[model samples]
Target: MKYIVCFSGGHSSALCAIECVRKVGKENVVLLNHNISEEVEDKDIKRFKQEIADYLGIKITYANMEGWEYKTPLRVCKELGGFKFGNGPALCTYNLKTKPFYKWLRDNFPIEKGSIRDDVRIIYGFDKNEPSRIQRRIGVMINQGYKCEFPLAFWDRTITCTEEIGIARPNTYKLFKHANCKGCLKSGKQQWYLTYCLYPELWEEAKQVENEIGYSIIKGSFLEELEPKFARMKCKGIVPTEKIKPQTFWAMVRKEIPDKSENLPCECAL
Candidate 1:
């Protein structure tokens, strides 16, 4: 059976691809990479894609969203009205990622008339830790007449050797375990704070997008409104230089809050 694995050029998605290749073999698997406008300018993102492509030896199908363009949650909020709590960046996901993914699936692999082979399953690389996100993905797939599987979800539930090592070797310990867009609105203030310190250019770009759209991804606060507040709260957080290591940040976040698995309200971006 043919399987299409959605690739966001992030670690989670890469892990998902690796697992799929392990299960389905590389030939029957396709790496469907979405080329959202923001992502197009990211050199690190491009490198990630290349790394995955070289490692997998699978052709990456770069797909654009056609008429759809990158719009932050702030943009959507502005179009709808003023930004409010839980507005802006959240809505951006639906337009740029989820909706585009659905559209691509419809155009390339129709659901009706048994268009997809019966054995086909869409695999998402949501780690075992993110149950809410997995559930949401499953819900969306069901609505689209597809089945979803989460290999990492089960793995993430149990403590591992890696965790033991990470605990002992704190500096060696990687922070920030989850993977998605660098400035994804779903990411909390800490993550955004790290992004601001590490990739100031991208962070500034995100701010510009928010300003241009005249909304804030963080609902009640615009970037301009939130920046001063973020500046005031100072911590000896690791200042990322040059490259932002995704794995390191994931580990750091996980370390700070061991039981932070609760789902925030879906910002309707996805």
Candidate 2:
């Protein structure tokens, strides 16, 4: 039985790839990444794919979901009259990532006629910190007749701090965090602010998408309406001397309150 590590080129999947390689050896493991033209840049995507392959010294396969057109959440919102504030970006996750991922799995490893063994596990990199996301991914894999393992689920600051203070940092954490598309609709305002300052081209692309779709994704207001307010706003708040790490930010947030169990599976989990 082959052990496949589905690589989304995200932080979670990157960590999964590393753990899978260490446990099963590189020869028996495969890293799988999908390419969708519209959602992410071709150059950035290729770099991510190559980086993983080089880091693990393993052969990685690139899969293109046939006729997979890149459709942003904004487009879906325009067609469906927009989801509630938190729910708007969820549609993009289902359509762009999850659906294509499952489709690829079925095509390559068919279930009918019992072609593949049921025990072959799929490794996902959902961290222990994200209970809701971890549960959703596990539930989906179980329904698909595959066991799911999460190696980085319980990884904490000790491991991260040790790595950072040491000679090297994990490829998963460094590359994947910055690898998210510059204008990811799912990102919060802080992320969007950084994107606006750092990568204007991608920000413009997002704006164009919103305009073409005739819908706003920011919720409660459109970018066209918000731009003026943003322009007029003064930078009164102190800028941090060092940028806060994503993991640190999540850790701090998690400490402020108990993690809530999601009553319903995220629509993206589908």
Encode model 1's per-residue lDDT on 1-270: one tens digit a residue: 767777776665667777677676998888888665554234556666666666778988866645445544434445555433453334556656666777877787788863433666777767767889988888867777788777567533332222232312112114344434556566656567756655676677768777766656665656665454344332324454313665765466456433333122222323
The segments of candidate 2 whose C-alpha lies over 4 angstroms from its true place after superposition are 36-48, 66-91, 113-117, 154-178, 233-270
My TM-score estimates for the predictions, one after another, are 0.65, 0.67
Screening candidate 2 with a backbone cut-off below 3 angstroms (N, C-alpha, C), the clashing residue pairs are 128-153
Candidate 1 has an lDDT of 0.59
Q: Mind giving the per-residue lDDT tens digits that candidate 2 earns over 158-181?
A: 232222323233332332354454
**Candidate-wise lDDT, in order:** 0.59, 0.57
Clashes of each: 24, 1
